[model samples]
Target chain A: MNKGLLIVLSGPSGVGKGTVCSVLRKKMPDLVYSVSATTRSPRQGEIDGVNYFFKTREQFQEMMACDALLEHAEYVGNCYGTPRDFVERTLAGGQDVILEIEVQGALKVKEKFPEGVFIFLVPPSLDELKQRITGRGTETQDTINHRMTVAEEEMNLLSHYDYAVVNDEIEAACHRIESIITAEHCKASKYLAELGELPAAIEKA
Target chain B: MNKGLLIVLSGPSGVGKGTVCSVLRKKMPDLVYSVSATTRSPRQGEIDGVNYFFKTREQFQEMMACDALLEHAEYVGNCYGTPRDFVERTLAGGQDVILEIEVQGALKVKEKFPEGVFIFLVPPSLDELKQRITGRGTETQDTINHRMTVAEEEMNLLSHYDYAVVNDEIEAACHRIESIITAEHCKASKYLAELGELPAAIEKA
Candidate 1:
């Protein structure tokens, strides 16, 4: 079986990445979404190993020290990280791995694995993004304002990514992400070794 | 409207490229398949400018001298080339341009337009390719053997291409090509410029 490609997708909040990824997973069965390992307490309905690999702070630190984490970051006094073993295992099994990480984590993964295709999802417009954030009604006006400021900072890092899909529509963004994954698999380096092993009889003739 | 992307696709003979490209073009109305300019006489039912530019030797040479041809080659005492003007115009008009040229021409276009996506289509296996060629029944056994030899040479250059798709199935191959094109447009360089120019009032606040 053909080995799978590693895809890293990053975007600001309110870009509908979760929705797009869910739909894409349904469309592509071979895709394995990498569940992160976090030190935070699991919320209700969040399953261990399925939602995230809930780990103790010491365990997370040990993984980080041992270089077992692809990327890790601290948020609100809790640590979140991606374990390298699961991703490698998935790829070894011929399953494509998707890491729906933040920009900082995405950059770290790119630094470690240059072959990983990094894609940033963008909102259609700042106004549209602000509208989406405000429409959520979960955050206070100050929190919404803080997110808008963070979005600008993320947009500044757009140049570092391989591709940027505008979240104008969830379907279109998913399609773009799916396409990048498919195209990356078609790179020549992956097939050259197999092609080189063509039967000697065929080669000689 | 954003300018369209330039895509160049090349593959060994008997890879079902024609069928795949036809399906892709039909599915994407905005895609324009570039027609070549050739000194060779048109066969039956071939129309000028549609099938080929049908240029005289002198006209072809003039194009070559003026550096108006993106890529050109001579075969069997006839000269064939891609007209740069038409392709540029089509791209400027916001229509993605698809150049289904030979490997050499594809390389030339890549050198001329570094941003152009280069896709190399490959068959599943040499034996399958030979079978397909023989199944066509249009070529003699000797011709088929010669073509197979040529296919090996073409495969050697696959490393230079950005993507290598296996033409095991026409529909899948077309889908892959279409996806590559869509993904290419999402490159950060293309969209970041527009995003950068958002009104300063919105950006600063």
Candidate 2:
């Protein structure tokens, strides 16, 4: 069996990455979602190893010290990280893994796992992104302005990704993401082992 | 608007490239089929500039001298070449162009146009490819052996391609090809112009 792919998905704040990912999971049920490890206390309804692997700061620091985490960062006073063991086990069992992360975390994953397929999700347009952010209705103007500035910075990081999916419509974006995954499997590098066996196989035939 | 893509499709004979391409053209009507310029006389019902742009030996040589053809080769004592002008114009008009050529001609085209997306069509397996070749009925055992040897060589060239579409089922293969085209359009390199305008567009908004 072929080894599963390691996919890193990143986008700006209001690009609706979570919704796209949810629909994509429905389409590709076999996909493995990487649950993060965080030092922050779990809120109501959050389960250990389901929503997140809640850890104390010392435990999170221990994983980092041992080089057990794939990528990690401190955010809003909480330490969050992706565990390497679960990802490797899932891939070794021929199941693809997707890490939906912030741009900084995604870039850090890229540095550690260059072989992973990096995808950037974008809104249909900047105007659409602003509308989505505004549609949430819970944010103050100050928070909205800060998010727009951050979105601009993230959009500039498109060059770092291998593929981009524009979330004009949820279904269309999911389809593109699925296509990218299928196409990535068909890359020549993925078949090197089988291709190498061809000459001998032909001689026998 | 984004510029169109230059796509090269190649596979061993009997891999059903022509069939898949015909089906693809039906689905993607805007796709431009590249017509080769040939010194060989057009067979009955083959129209000039449609089947091929028939050219005299002198005209063909002039194109070669001027480097107007993207790739050319002498085959079965007839000169054949892809005209660069037609392809460029179609792409500039935002229409994707598909070039169906043999492996040798494809590698030659790659040298001149590395930006082109190269796709290899394949049978599900080597045994299946051999079966397809033998099923062609017109060839003797010796002729079949020669073709099989050549097929193996071409399959080894899979590394030269960006994507591989297995013709196990025509519709599935076509769908994959279509997906690849859509996904390719979303690549960052294809959207640099639009991306460059994002900051200003956001500032104005």
Candidate 3:
């Protein structure tokens, strides 16, 4: 069996990565959602292994020192990271793994797995992104302003990704990502190395 | 408006390039079919400048001498070439162009337009390709053997293409091409160069 694809979906903050990921996983049940390890305490109803591999700061630091994480970052006084072993095992089993993460982690993953498909999701517009952040009605003006600056910086990171998908609507974004997946499968860059011969691919076709 | 995409579809002889192209065009009305200039005589019901830009041997040679053709190849004592000017004009107008040609000519086009999206259409298998050629009922045994050799050589040229699509069934093949088009538009490689800013693309989204 072919080793499964590693799809990293990430974008700027407040760009709806989480929402898109949940809907996408529902539509594509075969794509395994990678669980991360975090030092933050789990919220109510969150399972230990299902939602995250919750750990103490010392344990998280140990995992990092052991190079057990694919990518990690500190956020709001807590460290979050993707466990590298799980992703490798799932892919080795010919099941695709999707990591819904932030820009920094996604870029870090790229450094390790250059072959992984990196998709940078963007909000429809900067103004709209501001509106979404502002519409939340919880963030102060300073927070919103700070987010806009971060969003611009994240968008500039678009050059590092393989594809940029605008999260304008849920279904449309999902469909475009689905198409990107299909296109990547058909990419000659990978096909030539994978099949090694036309007869085999033709026969399988 | 963004410039249109130039899609080159090529494969070994009798792999259904013409058949698949016709079906794909029907499904995608916006894709412009590129007309080739050929030294071959017009067959019954074939119109000059439509089916092909019928050209005399002298005129075809003159066009080649002037480097007016994107790519040209001779077969069965006749020359066929794509008119570069027409394709250029169409794409400059933001209309996508589709070129259905043999492998050699497609490779030549790549020399001038390295950015062109090259798709290699393959039959399901070597046996199936052979069956399709034989099913045509027009080749001598020597010709069949010769074509098989050429097909193998052509498949080897697949390393030059961006995609390898199997012509298993016409509809499935067309749908795959359609997905490729959608996927190409969303490609980050082109997006970074085309849009230049996330705000622009996001707003459009």
**Candidate 3 docking DockQ:** 0.54
Off by over 4 Å in 1: A40-47, A55-59, A65-67, A140-142, A193-205, B41-45, B56-58, B134-145, B193-205
Across residues B1-205, which tens digit of lDDT does each residue of candidate 2 receive?
Answer: 5678998888886788877988999999988999889898876677998768999999999999998998997754678899989898998888899988777778899998898999999888778888988996766898788777778888888888888888999999998888888778878666666556656756665
- Compute the lDDT of residue A63 as modeled in candidate 1: 97
Interface RMSD of each: 3.3, 2.1, 3.3
Give the candidates in order of DockQ, highest first.
Answer: 1, 2, 3
Q: TM-score of each model's B chain?
A: 0.86, 0.83, 0.90
**RMSD in Å for all candidates:** 3.0, 3.1, 3.1
Which portions of model 3 show Cα errors greater than 4 Å? A40-56, A137-142, A197-205, B41-51, B197-205
Candidate 1 on A60-121: residue-level lDDT in tens? 99999999998998754578899999898887788889998767788888888887888888
Give the CA lDDT, 0 to 100, for residue B46 in model 1. Answer: 74
lDDT of 2 at A32: 95
Question: What TM-score does each of the candidates earn?
Answer: 0.88, 0.88, 0.89
- Native contact recovery (fnat) for each candidate is 0.72, 0.60, 0.76
lDDT of 1 by residue, B3-50 (tens): 778988888877776667778889987789999898989867779988
